[model samples]
Target: MIKPKHNYTGKPTAYLDHNILNYFLRHPETSAFEKIFEEQQVVYSDETLREIKRSKGKENDFLNKLKKLNAMHFKIFVDENHQSTNDAIISDADPFEQYARLCEQLHIIDKIYTATNNTLRKFHGDKSLPSIEELDQQQSSDFIMILEELMQKKSNTDTLTSEQLTKLNNYISRTLQHQKTIQELSTKMMLNYQRDDNASMINTYRAKVGIGPLELNNVKGPKIIEKIWSLHKDLDGYKGRNFSIEDFLGINYIPSNLNGCIPTSSKIISAYNVLNVIGYFNDSDLKLNRRFTSATSDANHVALASFADTLYSSDIGMIKKGRAIYEFLDVRTKIITINVIDNRPL
Candidate 1:
């Protein structure tokens, strides 16, 4: 086994999904993201490029634009044909995920930082805002009160001369109109209307605030410590049960911003989806957690999953991507940055 190195600071090799690459190329006006994209060297494979080619319309345009913007930045790798491998591993290819899987097989993913919108509950009212239906229930009572107040204010007004009343009514109308406009604006901001279904607007806001994706905030590193410890104890293969929590935090604690490993094979791809939902990253705040394959029933062997036909499972599909960063609080009560990763898929 490879021993963990203490002073292991070095440039990270990241696998950019095609979609994420497009976001950068398409959003040139987004100067901040452009800077982030410029920081990492992009890796791809010929198969991935072909996938890009096979893609049509906007997808094609996006890839074409990226190829033009920084042609020199992309590195294409061709691993091997797993023709003789078990039928379990055989699957249709998605170049982006494939390249990422390849990276994992090669042990090149030091950390995978995926940027995503905040999927956590927002602090609002007495409790964090609930789902829209629950929010409607809570606000319904307040809505009645507001309407009643409006009626009372309207009824108490003095009857005036025709011209004066006309002016007054106009003023009231304008005020109500303005309030309507303000309400609309407020609703849009609060409920996040006019935002992409993928919550890209939330992402833009988080980026503006210098906060990373909310998903990363949920990566349970400590819980992972617990699980890893349990695995060490319960699993017969793990010999070193003496690792401390600090060591686990420092070593196994993968920041959301750090891309840990790539998913070069279909089995690894399946593992990514499985791990993502299994909540292996429960303690991580940066949503830095990713699904990975582990030893199976047989200690000597591991099993991989299929990708093409089964990639769309609702569970793994739920893993949203955006900009996630890693942070730790210092003695001064200040947040220190460790890493940053954009979750826009390649």
Candidate 2:
């Protein structure tokens, strides 16, 4: 295979998305990818590990391929001692941890809502609702189990006072409302620059620079306020529910450095802006596909790729967004689609 002429400071690092891993597993004898893997320093992340676990019976096969590549896996969290484990290297504290904590908090709220609603239904003589004991038996998380035990205590006493019942009902109502908001925020977080109306202008500039123009769809609206509000509310510690575009513009939440990858922070923010400029976040009817949360994963992959010299992904969405972000940010990291590498002459 002919190598590209780009100069390198060290070994050429290649970040592989989980899809590429699956592709390689399905075509183990494919010489194209084998050669690329042999020539590049491949890296992956905890997200890849999670994806591997979801591969059902093919987990070991994927692992063996990654092993052969001498792939480096980065952890989402790191030990306090900053020691590297067999699984992943230690990373400094970052926004991902904050996002994780928020998710955990949201999860607990969801569990509380489920438990309280179930209990309230039982109180109304609904036979379908599980008893507190059954909830205890089923709950796996510590917070969920604690909630179950509390409900069980209340059940055993058989003394659910009117005031207590009223409070419990109020709590359930609040949680239900917040759950809707959380779902909205999660969806907005998933929207990307898959469509941009400014393709011509972007391409015009790319042509001047001797590169291909980006294909983007135009998206616009007042609904963008809702998405911006949700992000500010959930991520930026903004207490207000209402926010203007100016407010979102004024918030400096993006970290300046992401574990030495200076361009990653700007690239992530650029991806968000790319979608925002096209009015993606403004569409209330638009929601993240529940089957897979690709936007979040894509963003995470981009961040992880900052450590590598190149990124390899079969996902067109990832490639498009990554290319746009890297180009906009002037990041040196090469964002190449898996097909491009696979199609290389051997």
Candidate 3:
């Protein structure tokens, strides 16, 4: 459990999400977020840059837009032992230059995306193979070629050599094992997703404790808190009689983030999705994707902004989920939703 240590001083820092920054990009003259920038030590992170890069041709255009907000880049550093993690950023990061330098220096976008995707799977304990996607494709193509050669050999025993037969048999066995592993992983992923089904979890809890669905909007309130606690205690083997918000987000096995067990960023991202699965500050409608796995950017934003004094976002979902997760993790960051700001107070 690791909490990001910031050399924060001076003004209160407010980390801005992609949406809020995009809003500023669109309405360059708008003063809606002006107050936040005026008083807060506004900061941006790689999450903001990642979303900007997704804009494709307009990536540079959006990168340039970061200058308008006067925001610094905020990145949480990993342990010194894991320096190879490659997610580190300068402590007093210049938002525009740092982001631009990153895009030029490395194809960090693709690397980070794959890393985050697998981390999300780990979060849910989803057994979707460790994303050896390139290896899978290469192996698949090789297997097909081998199968074609094997078919050709069957038509004429004269052409099939002893060495070829041995090699083909070995390849065939390896391919079959690979296919079996893939199938097993897929099955596990399917089962994990099913277990996280909001309705299903709710119904199961109800069956055992007579508690129905939870109040999605007021997830932080007593009503929703009580339901979550009862569900966990009665069905999920949570032993604590009283509700511990920290347990809701932090890795329960670890005594605390103070001991440096799990990286706080991973916990934040993982816990955000966990909150959604159980229906707190829900990101999805419960219609499809029981877990809000698609809210990967939101999760990134939450983690990046953990050490900041504040987080400013126009997204209500980010606001709610950020607030709840921050509370549970004991992060001191303040969450200011644009809608809740009231007439763009400046």
Candidate 4:
């Protein structure tokens, strides 16, 4: 394999996304060069660093790992000021913008190799920097790409077969299974909330995932507010039966899209219509409490057994909502349709 002469004087920096660096640090095979890369100028934002430092003390170990790299190899700078302004500049309004801003700041200092996919465009948005897409099309992906490229540097070297590459990718994916599972489950919860037009849960989920919600003006008709108020009035703990449209907006509640995409929401609305066919939700908190209470693993099983009797007493609306969801997914497919109600709040 052809190796570049160590004499090259170009400013080549290493940019690490907080999460990706964490992944590498935890992986024994990839982290073999932890000492070598420590001396390199490592790029990361102050916000990310602070978050890592405050939330995960393990980051101190990663920092120490960086300290072992040769003197001229790594530089760490905290990015506090630029991130906030950069967030203000972006219209799309996802929290990822903060990382994009960090990339922009890093590019000003040197030619850095960044580990983030989303911020590549932001870094290359200026005429001076080559767009990531342009660079990839002309050359190859960076960092990992550089490693793979180096493996094929020899004139007669055999390239990895498709099957070999696939196996490697699968291995990497499986190795990262725990993180992926949490992410997927979080996505499922967000998708469920979005379908239900549960504005509160939507904001909660977005915040949980480190993304910001785009400002949207769509509102559910007054009928929804009236129904919710009337139901709340009947519920014992409901503080007030009267709320302004502003109250809903204050909660960042957006109209639930009742389209075909969210079958869970469809099941919920369908169940509610059926419940009105029966004599449910005539009282106040009775409907709200019965549906929205938390359940233990034991309670969930018991709830399933006596669901018929429990249906009219517990949070009917919430149970129906959750049931609609449970049905659409059909994890426990034997559930009676009557026991189901969309549990998520709009």
* Tens-place lDDT digits, model 3, residues 44-113: 7766776776666777667666666566775666432221122334355555677667777345344434
What would the per-residue lDDT of candidate 2 be over residues 1-346, giving only the tens digit for each residue?
1122453344577888887777776665666776776767676666565565557787667767777777655443322222121122422233234334445555555455454333222222234434434533343243346555555555566566666655554543443453344333423432221123322222233233232212222212224334434443443323454644434433233222213322344345435533422333221111223222344456667766765678888776566556655554456788777664554422
Model 1 is weakest, by summed lDDT over 10 consecutive residues, at 293-302
**For residues 127-184, what per-residue lDDT tens digits would candidate 1 score against the true structure?**
2334443444444444444444544555577754455544445544544443344334
Better of 1 and 3 by lDDT: 3
lDDT of 4 by residue, 1-346 (tens): 1222343232333333333345445654654334434443433333343334433557555554434432122112112210111011101122244334544554422222232211222221222334434544333233344434333442234675565555445433432342234233333433443423323432343344332212111213334434433443333322353644333222212122222122222233333322222223211221232211121111232222221111211344334433433333342322222221242112
The window of 10 residues in a row where model 2 has the poorest summed lDDT is 282-291
Return the top candidate by lDDT.
Answer: 3
Global lDDT of each model? 0.32, 0.48, 0.57, 0.31
Clashes found in each candidate (C-alpha, N, C closer than 3 A): 51, 10, 2, 26
Predicted structure with the largest TM-score when compared to the true one: 3
TM-scores for the candidates: 0.27, 0.46, 0.61, 0.20
Over all chains combined, what TM-score does candidate 1 have? 0.27
